[model samples]
Structures are given as C-alpha cells and as structure tokens.
Target: MATPVLPRSVQRLIDEFARLPGIGPKSASRLTFYLLRATDNQALDLSVALQELKERTRLCSVCFNITEDDPCPICEDEARDAHLVCVVEEPLDVLAIERSRAYGGRYHVLHGAISPVEGIGPEDLRVTELVQRVAQGQFTEIILATNPTLEGESTALYLQRRLAEYGVRMTRLARGLPVGGDLEYTDEITLGRALEGRQEV
Candidate 1:
C-alpha cells in the first residue's frame, strides 16, 4: 500500500528544503514545519532577505568575487599589494584567507576549480580575465591558492602552464592545510601558517 500524501503546500515546502545541500527528508520536514509555525514577520523577513541577496549581490568585475560593489573593497583598497595576487577557487576561500589576516595582497576569484568529473574546464573559470589582467598590468607574483584536492591541483597546473609567458613568480600554499580538505573549512591558524610557508610551484 502507498503512503498517504501530505498536504500539497506542506509537501512543497518540504521538497524545497530537501533540495538544499545536506538537508535530508527528516530535516527538511522539521524546517518546513518550523517555518510554518514561525511568525509571519520572521518568514517574510527571510523571504525578503533572500530576494535582496539576489538583487543586491553581483560579481565584482575585476576579481569575479560576489560583492555588492563592482570592484569590491579589497580591489579598491590602495593599501593592498596589487603586484601580489592570490588566486582562489571561490569567494568562500577568500573569506577563509581573510580570516587568517595573513595576507595583504589583492585576489582573483576563479569561482570554481577545473573538475573533469563535473565537465568544468579552465574556460569555465575566470582564467582568461586573469591572463588579460597580467598582460595589462606588470604583476610580480601570483599565488595558486586553490584547495589541495586533485581538481584543485589540476587547476593550478593548468594556470601555471597558461601563465608561463608572464614570467611572474607563482607559488602554492604549504602543507599546513589538510591534503583533501577545503580552504573554506580550514582553521585560521593553519591557514595563516600555510600562507606564511607558501612555496614556489
């Protein structure tokens, strides 16, 4: 015998919540019910926040990081070393690095790594823009601060080859970061040490 169907509205909310990463059916049901019982103002606030997040947030034209501003505060900050750029896989990685307070260089967010399994390539990333930026400006160094995963290593190597003609010093993060861990989840102390001990690629 088939299970009885839930009310369509409740089922729809559960389905939406279940689609989120790491949210199982049970958790989705809990969240949907919680939201249903929440104050109308609270739920409306969340809905309005989500709408504004989509409307107010945009990719920074220069670094490709998600920001409310075009250049982003980091890119616009004259105090940062423009000649030394740290290239990361995503905006979350940028936050991880910033939390360490170990770097004072500008950054270039690739938005994602080159993953063959996912059918993502260098062309899918902000690689061409980085190359053009290097061509336009005489940068001294570039750090391939992508994660230590196989896909990250592949992306780093691809960038290395592509930027060979630039003659700019390229470096990779040290082993302080766990081999298979993501930068966004790394502790600040370990991330700081990795930045401090970064080595030539």
Candidate 2:
C-alpha cells in the first residue's frame, strides 16, 4: 500500500520530533497526533514554552552552560567554592553532580567530549575558555569530572596536558564510575563516592 499523507504542518512537526535524540519516527508520529488532538490552549502552551526556552536561555559566559544570564546562578553563588572547579561535559552532567549534594564547587561545562569519529575536537568545545579561566589564578583546583567514556577519557587527558602549566591541583573523578558510562545516568550514591574519592591526575 502507498504511504498515507499527513497534513503538511503535522508532518513538519513529526519530522522535527524525529530529529531529537532517542525519538524515533513512530514516537514522533504519536507525539504529532497527540498534539493535534490536544486542546488549543494545551497545544499553544507547549508551543509558547518551547519558544521561551530558546528565547530566554543562552550559555553562561563563564562556564558555557545554558542559562538565562551571562553567568549562571551557580557561577554567581558566593557560597560555592570558587577555588575548586568541577569540569563536566554538559549542563546535564552539572545537574547530575548537584543531585549528589556532595560537591560544593563551581563547574566548567565543556558542552561535549572530544570525539574524533564525530568530528568533535578541542576547538569545537569550550577548551580555550577553560584554559583562560585557569590562567586567571582564581581557581586552585581543577577536577576533571568528564564522563568515563573513551571520548571522555581522551578529552580529560587532553585537558590535563593543556592545563598543566597553571600549577593548579588537578584531579580525576575516581574509578567507581563504570568505564563506559555517561555521568548523566550514574546514580547519586555512586557519583557521590566517586566525587569523594577523586585522585590527583
């Protein structure tokens, strides 16, 4: 049988949804149809929320994490240990670390790991900004909290070499995190232990 045609607008939304990570064509179609059936106010509410998400948020100038301000709230908070910086791969990783409540330091979000296969390299991320931050002589410790993947390890080693000249305390998150695991999925207990047991690089 020939494929049935969907409304142009509906099909457009479905295509957009299908492009998102982990969302397949079937799930995208389901979401599009669900939105089609939703009350006008409900659908409009979601539309407005999505618009505002892009309109109101930008990367933090300091850490490069998504934020509504130049510096994110975490960067501005005086209570956090400014001398200690936990370097993570993304904003999601920052949330993961915060959930553990075991770290009271500032964060530097690299936004992504160095994946040569994916065409992502040090220049593609916020590495230069991190080097500049360390050169400022404000932070005393640099914690390499990037995920435990091969790419993550590669990125961490690259950072270690790049930042070695600053004469700062550099440490890596301990071995409790699985070798192939992403930090975003690690449980609080395990993540907390890893934070506590971090060792010098």
Candidate 3:
C-alpha cells in the first residue's frame, strides 16, 4: 500500500525533527503526531523554548560553555579555584562534572573532540582561545577531562603538546572500573587503567 501523503507543515516538522541527532524518521513522525494530538500548548511551548534557546543562549567567553551570561556562572564565581581549569570535550561534559560536585575548579569546553574521520580538527575548536588563556599565566594546572575515546585521546594529546611550553601542570582524568562493576565484565582498557592508577589502600 502506498504511504498516505502528509500535509506539508506536518512533513516539514517531521523532517526538522529527523535532522536532530539520534532522532530517526519514525521517532520524528511519532513526535509530530503526538504534538498534533495534544490538547495543551506543548507544541507552542516547545517552539518558544527552541526559539529562546537559539536567541538567548550564547557561549561563555572564558570557557566556551553555553550560557545566557558572557562568562557563565562558574567562570564568574570568585569562590571557585581560579588557578585550576578542567578542560572537557563539550558543554555537556561541564554539566556532568558539575553534577559530580567533586570538582571545585572552573572549566573550559572544547565544543568537540578532534575527529579526523568526521573532519573536526583543533582549528575548528576553541584551541586558540585556550592557548591564549594558558599564555596569560593565570592557571596553575589543566586537567584533561576529555573522554577516553580515540578522538578524545587525540584531542588531549594535541592540547598537551600545544600547552607544554606554557609550563602549566597537565593531568588526565583517571580511568578505571566503576564502583560496583565486576572485574570479569570489565573491559581490558578500563581494567588496565585501574591497575595503572591504583592508589595505596
């Protein structure tokens, strides 16, 4: 049977939703139909929220994290350790670290990792800004909090080389098994890292 033709507006919304990362055509169609069936102002609210997200949010000048303010709250907070900076792959990573509540220092969002396969490189990121920050001689250490993926590793290595001359202490986030994970189920990389980073009990 031929697929029934959808209205242009409905199809357009579905197509837009489908363009979002991790959203398949079927999921987009479901979302569009769900919005159509809704009696409340959810669709309008979503539209307004999206508009505000684009219009109101901007990158923090210092850290490159998404924020309504220029420096972002973390960068502006004087109580935080100004000399310690944790460099991460994206704005979401900053949020993840914040949720941990273990890090009391500020952050620097790289926007993305160095993925040559995806055509992303240091030039495409805020590397220049980070280098400039390092050259300013304010930070005493830089924690490389990039993920353990190949791209993340490459980005971290490149950053290390670039900032080595600045003489600021550079450290990587320790990789290991999870708190409750089984040793048998753990991957070799994580297990090895755990062994390498083992601390005296």
- For lDDT, the strongest prediction is 3
In model 3, the worst 10-residue window by lDDT is 38-47
Candidate 3: stretches off by over 4 Å: 1-4
For model 1, the local distance difference test gives: 0.92
Per-residue lDDT of candidate 1, residues 58-92 (tens digit): 99999988899988999999999989999999999
Model 2, 16-64: lDDT tens per residue?
A: 9999999999999999999889999999999999999989999999988
All candidates' TM-scores? 0.84, 0.86, 0.96
Model 1 lDDT-worst window of ten: 170-179
Ordered from best to worst TM-score, the candidate numbers read: 3, 2, 1
Error of 3 at 56 (Å): 0.3
Candidate 2 segments exceeding 4 Å error? 1-4, 177-201
CA displacement after TM-score superposition, residue 130 of candidate 3 (Å): 0.4
User: Clash totals for all models, in order?
Assistant: 0, 0, 0
Model 2 alpha-carbon miss at residue 139, Å:
1.4
Q: Show pairs that collide, candidate 1.
A: none
- What is the clash count of model 1? 0
**Which residue pairs show collisions in model 2?**
none
